[model samples]
Target chain A: MSRRVRDRKRLEGYLPPEGVPISFSIASIGARFGAQVLDIALTYGFIILLVYAMVTTGALPIEAMFALIMLCVFLIRVPYYILAELVWNGRTVGKRIVGIRVINAEGRRLTPHQIVARNLMKEVELFTPVTMVFTVDAMSGLGVLLTLVWVLAVLIVPLANRRRQRLGDMVAGTIVVDNPRNVLLPDLALSLPAQGSVPHVFDFLPAHLDIYGRFELQTLEKVLRDPVRGEEPPDFGQISRTIIRKIGYADPVRPGQERAFLNAFYRAQREHLETLRLFGNRREDKFHSAPGS
Target chain B: MTDAVAEQDKRRTGSSPDSPAAPAPQGELLRSARFRVEREGHWRRLDELVVRAEKAGPASLSYDETRELATTYRQAMNSLSVARDISLDRALLDYLETLCARAYLVVYAPQESIGGLTGRLLSIGIPQAVRRSALPLLIGFLAMVLGAVAGYVLFTGDPGWFYTFVPPDLADMRTPEASVDYLRSTIYGNDFDAAETLAAFSSYLFSHNTRIAILIFSLGIFLALPSFALTFYNGLVLGAFFGMFAVKGLGYDVFAWLSIHGVTELAAICIACAGGARLGLAVLLPGQRTRRDALREQAHDAVKLVILAALMLVAAAFIEGFLRQLVQDPKMRLAIGWGIGALWLAWLLLAGRSDEKQANEARGGSAP
Candidate 1:
């Protein structure tokens, strides 16, 4: 991958407390927006339900009602962001569901101070400006204009940066990143046919295996592993023909046996690359000349 | 076989005396298979632990499971490094990297107990931060004072200047046109049921002031000039309001009225601005350090001040809501205002002094 692309995707070279430099993908703006929308919906939905309940109960005097609602919103919304993040290690309910999380930009354990600072900043960057826009005296052009400007500025900040950090994130030195949970698949080489057991329909000799490298092997494995779909599956016949032609194999691959031919070639190529790696003759791609060749 | 094929095959699967797979050239794929077979148990175990931890908190793990997690994490890290060096399977390496990253996040997460965090925040963290950013605090305070003086002078000289300094919505009916008696009523006003409305008033004031404080602090990222400007403008509003009353010779009453909560509220604003000011100044002039480094370093204190200021605003809101209109005596108002101010000053200055050394050590221990 290109450095710029990798940098855009992953937070490179982050040293965790363990002192090992690791990297994680930066969450896409799309995911962040989705999480934010979910959060806003949930919080606002909650506040609406609460206000409805309070209004229906009539236990509170009309004069105190507004204040009670304000108190409820302030109490519920602020703590929901700050305390939830703290307890869940920078994940809110929406963030957890969306599979993204906030982390310290410096790769330290995220501090409570950072969490509070960032969330409070949301008051300015998002909540306040939005409320101001609605409540602004429409007659005063400047008031509406200023609110719009603030809203636009906040929106643009994240788009302009590689980290996709909004102003709050910048101030608090935090970034939102994808929470990955990839499972390790069994080694593909383990599926290779056993020696001296069921004679394979096709065999890949050393010459055929050596013609390809790790990259080609992986590409071929991907093709082989892809499940056949619909009436017209991938043209394994054409693919096998190309590989056979490229490797200068004299034998012909049977029409229906193309998949088996490719599978045999994949196993052989992977074995060849793994053996080369053990001997420190790692081949990155077809363009990467094998060691001593 | 062709000479080249035999030669390549022989070289590819070099001799291994202890031969299980090494005996046959085709069987040399055993290297990666063998590696996975040997260590798959640890990888699987670690994966299970991480999944469980993520689903629930680490507390869900048994003591033995926790110990196993540590060892498995180390082993995973080692495997990742070695795989990067020698493994040709990109999938395996990618899997290990992800595993290690997740494990690391869980393992080294800020494990500071909640009680310790709260104690430190109230005692050492907030006060030390306040003390460290004294320069910004002074600058913020002075900006407000200067703005207040400018506003007072301008409004006193020209009544028309009231429109220029204060927004109509904020000024409410406390305009130049209103009678002194009417303005006085606002200060001692209880037209609305005080007990019923005061709760709303307190919450409104709390949310509003907290929003402004947060805004000032966040705006500090833009070189702090905005923070200074915002603080000064607030001062202008106050000065002009006071000027209107001062013109009618109810200046002391107005001062007393505001002092009921103004001391805490205004101080909280200044402290919040100071948080922003420190942030702006650090970015503007990061001496001997990169701007990013300076910002990251200074942000700790700035955020602390903002949070502390926010809490202070909450208290100010309550006092203003409950007492400003209820307590009719000017002398009592002034005493209470100053009393609250004195307590805040004392707390900021002295609350964490006893544990200064201990606080530093505790903070250092928790920090990466």
Candidate 2:
């Protein structure tokens, strides 16, 4: 059971100084890559727009315009990252959209110092090599080789670790985790009865209810929740018969009434297991003998 | 039916049927229905508030809403813990966990005003950090000095070393073989387009120096060797340039020209390297703490130092762009350079000592 749980979402555990253990679902690399692409696209598009606006204005000589573009690029892009992360609490515009946010690995409040440290690293990792390629030596073999090596190192550093932290994140001790907006679904145990139909009731003797346990109850709950099938509606009749025979249920479940019967059985079996759980005799599945046997 | 058969097949091969014996709950069953019925309203309200807060900010909430947010967050945290213990509803646990996590992030975010933060960073943060890492700062300066001496010696021995020390484009007309008059003209040259060029020059200097400072700080993570080498190389370039002028007997003039800006710029470089060296040292000698812990602790101070250095570089660029050309007199230039340097020194030594002492006391009696 624990192995199955662990294989679900990869969780990074954080033990705060106050000793509260919090686990975050690590954002997938694909999602992070997508966010970066969006951010880069937006930043470059904005820079191009600014340059184009200035050029059309015809306000200065070519040399001056060139200098102004350089200044704008530095001023706009660098702060767009550092300031945006600071103000939005570790989320960039792209990060917000993609549902991932950076947090301190220690689970402490994100500090401005950390924000600046990480973003400055972006310059070293990405921008400097790019600038070198364009301005220093556009076509030199050595320059291209150097850039390729640097880029590869930057790319591989994250893949080398389980945390998916790039060089900046490692230095600053931050990690990006999925920040999803989730809604509490209505309780399955209560929903069917509230559909304006008469509440279906099923009574089972202790021996009949004691045949199953939590594991089987959970599987039954899954069936009750998702009745998805192709071409036609789910054949609840077959499921109801198998379950009825397994428990040697006494009631006659009509073909159309199987769902209602199943719902009642789920409620009763859950209640039985929960009661047994309270009595220190919790059953895991039907294969296990009842406690005290 | 097919799914059920597959599940039965898996069950036969799954964990052995002998269920592990363990203590179970001793009280009434915490039915998911009852729990949801009682708490669903609060969860929905919290969900609404968190959504609004995420879209805008926490400040977007009214006073009552803010109070409600806090109360509801605590209540949600309680719900999460309770659900973890008693409820087997995976969906409920997942929802509550996410809710509490979101609320925790929102509620515990730093609440400092921008004005207070900026004042603090300037008045004490930079100076205190510089004071703390004095050894690294000294080492950084010494490395530069050694490199400068090396460059001077090599250039004096062979004039060709000047070309090797300085980039060809930057050397322009300032070579050792250039006429002394031409060397003087480049320094005092205020042509008709001086204003136009100065604007570009200042921007270039600011961007270039800031980039170098950032690079030096970043490379400090790798044992500080790279940072030391870069700083030393910068010093070599400076020393070689000065050697070229000294050979022409215009050493004082060139010294004045450089000191006007180099005093601040070079100090800025040293500070940046100091930040990097501090990072390297943390990795080398973590002492009692783990290397990661040391790096994190020292990085806070290092970042402040580097940021201060970057800001100082901007100031230096402005002085170099305008004042160096306008103040042609070597003596006045020296006075301004030393004046700025002295002010920086005074600021570093004394800026926020009293304030820091009080903060230290408030934190827990004596300073570390």
Candidate 3:
């Protein structure tokens, strides 16, 4: 391949692993959900504690206590979901910790309007009182039977959806997905080495290059250094060949000659530079750094 | 020179080049490069350093590492040609965080659902309270109304009975001639002009009624007896006033005049009283729950009712101050009152119904 073409290919972003299926274990999903809850609880808990302390100390009125509680609950819970979904990309405090988040069925960030629509359903959940009993004893007796109707009306709608969306989600134009692992890579800082003495050269890459190039470089670094630690190390030659094919390269490297080929190729460029210096009269040294120097 | 040659030899071997014999310059460069790469590689290891720093009291990550990670992520984002790819990356990060949050919830608070257990309780708890209180509220209102009417009729039959019911302080204000002239004059009597007097009277009555309603609702700590007594007394006075007028052949006119503001104001007072009664009852009979628990539950219901009461009072004040005064004809007044009553009924039943479907949708939707 021409040098320019190779450089162009190198600049391409890291390709996501195909067919890996970004499915998360139920345990992980639960952890993420829990984290969000904790975040809210902590936030609201602090506010409530502050209010309670004030009220008890007579710094605030008892009526203010009620108002404050109501305010905190509304402000914290409503915006917690909406803003987190919209801005934080669906992971609340707990969700962030557990490595799970909400996304569209197609695995995309939700819009603000969608977040608002989904959150307003909270009022419905607040106003309706009979729905909870339905869950407790759907099959027990006549009361249970009646409660079942109410429960069915509320809960059944969401169950019918492929994405398990409730009426609000449907109206709001959103879906919740398990936070896919690929999104976590950036936050995980997986591209950079975690610990070492060497000054990273990749940092010098100009910022104007698109995210794809940066990702590619980072991925290249990771792949080079980490190299998947179990079993026999992946045959770099075969792997490189497969990557090349996947990326639309036509030439294939032969087995057992991959390392020699790379070394010779780098060396040939260095020798070519020497030839340029010895024969062709270039005013200044044309080649600064030797290949693989 | 010997050491430099040895270091070069070591570099050729590539066997842990940080060996003691490695040349200072080469070793330093290699070490720094290796360190930088390793340091920048992963979040988990970086987090370990942070954790250690925290354990040791205070620590922070290197600024260079922070900047590098940020740049890398930004680059990844910019590289995406397809919105779908960027979305997927965002989704992955979101998922990871959510997983962490969910794990925390499971460990710390297993009971909370996305809608929250409090929300569930509110859904069931409020309506249940309302339904339970509805019978008592209706019965109490009806009984008071009937008692007032009965007392009015009996007292008017015997004019002397007025003194028995009326307090000594208010007795002198009554007219012996049994006239509408006296009541209208009393209502309109003031240094101000008739319009001003009427307006001020309406405003005073409207505010007084509201204050009384608020007091009844808020003084649940006193077991609500004061509020019930106040309701009963007001009802008796209303019945007596109407019965006296009916005896004088002015009952129809009086009914219209009273109802112009009475309907909403009375209803609001009753609602407030009902809220107070709920609180009192919760205190008196803490059924399956403890007193505090019952009080808390009752307080929630009472608050909703109080809000409803406040709305009604505002309607009452508007009618009393503007509508009632503008339409002096008794028939017109009655029609307006009835219209307001109908409007209130419609609202109580239907105001928030349009969003019911949306609310249900929300409940059913995924936690995302």
Candidate 2: CAPRI quality band: incorrect
TM-score of decoy 2: 0.84
Candidate 1, overall lDDT? 0.79
Ranked by DockQ, the better of candidates 2 and 3 is 2
List model 2 lDDT by residue over B136-234, tens digit each: 999789878988888988889998999888998888867888898999898777762557677678878888888888888888887888899999998
Output the number of the TM-score-best candidate.
Answer: 1
For each candidate, the DockQ is 0.38, 0.23, 0.02
lDDT of 1 by residue, A93-160 (tens): 89998999998877677888778877877877777677787798753888878777888888898999
Weakest 10 consecutive residues, lDDT, candidate 2 chain B?
B11-20
Model 1: per-residue Cα lDDT over B1-368, one tens digit each: 01211233343422222223223454354455555566778988999999898778788899999999999998888777666655656568778888988888778764334668988799888988898888999988987898899889999999888999899988888899999899988888777566778878888999888878888887887799999999999999888989999999899999999898999999999999999998899899999889877887788899899888888999999898888877899999999999999999998998778787787799899976
Candidate 3 iRMS, in Å?
A: 18.1
Which stretches in model 1 have alpha-carbon errors above 4 Å? A1-8, A15-21, A57-60, A75-79, A128-156, A191-201, A226-233, A290-293, B1-29, B110-112, B357-368
The true-versus-predicted C-alpha distance at residue B324 of model 3, in Å, is: 2.4
Task: Output the number of the DockQ-best candidate.
Answer: 1
Clashing pairs in 2: none
lDDT of 3 by residue, B1-368 (tens): 11221222122211121222223343433321222233233433333333333222221336665454344333323222221221112323343333322222222211112345335433443344445478447734764586587669767778665665666555456543546787665443333435544445555555555556655665443466655776776677667666766776676777888788788888777887787677678778889878645665566566556556766886787677666657777778888888788877665554545455675588679534
1 versus 2: better lDDT goes to: 1
